[model samples]
Target: MSYTYDYPRPAVSADVVVFDSSTDSILLIQRKKDPFAGSWALPGGFMEMDEAADATAIRELKEETGLVVAQVEQIGAYSAVDRDPRGRVVTVAFMAEASTSESIAAADDAADAKWFPVDDLPELAFDHSQIISDCFSKSDKG
Candidate 1:
């Protein structure tokens, strides 16, 4: 059941911000692909046809970082036109808390995975720096 659309549709993706409050750190992954290869970013990917945004966040988190988070709260949607270099892509961001003790390994499209202090993060890919900042700001307010 494929149908052609007259207008172009933007790709939708989901991203997760896993924060460890005790350590004041966040989990990040080094991308393996060319869009931002070797750069650190959140655990995320394009959404699948059948899964919801939250499900995409969880699945991508597990697939890329080998971390299974039980739940997450929505941060918000980011739809900046130039956010993604690949094309017009809008991302729904989610946040969760995880223990720094939890084991994680790089897999799938992630070259590496590790936790970094929120205040001392490496340069990030995409709009991830802004995403992380927004997450913290929201948390601070709420």
Candidate 2:
């Protein structure tokens, strides 16, 4: 059987560098799915067709955190070979920061979602560690 090459590769997604200036901490969710089950990672998910990158970011963020996204800034795009264990996936990383003093719990595929100090990060799944680092570097001086 011949496969259809007309379709573009499926895309993956992730939100990074979420921080609370009050606590100087970054937000992350404990993944409840495979490829890094039980590991803490940035809030994100797969991208759906017809939705803009930022739209996906807002949707995922709200779904995972239960907090309406107040602001979003596009950080960068990462498409490393083998970045995703499932298949070739491109991720658009977005930075979201807003004031929300309330404690957050997980919603979707995340077992739990919480904030951690940026400098004192836990071992994250995938190349998420790198994504977070790049985000920090950009705002490090600002």
Question: Which candidate comes out best when scored by TM-score?
Answer: 1
Local error of candidate 1 at 131, Å?
A: 0.7
Q: After superposition on all CA atoms, what RMSD does each candidate show versus the true structure?
A: 1.6, 3.3
- The residue pairs found clashing in candidate 2 are none
Write one digit per residue (lDDT tens) for candidate 1, span 1-142.
Answer: 9999899899999999999988899999999998999999999999989999999999999999999998889999999999999999999999999988999999999999999988899999999988988998888622
| Candidate with maximal lDDT | 1
Q: Rate the local accuracy (lDDT) of all candidates.
A: 0.94, 0.81
CA error at residue 29 for candidate 1, angstroms: 0.1
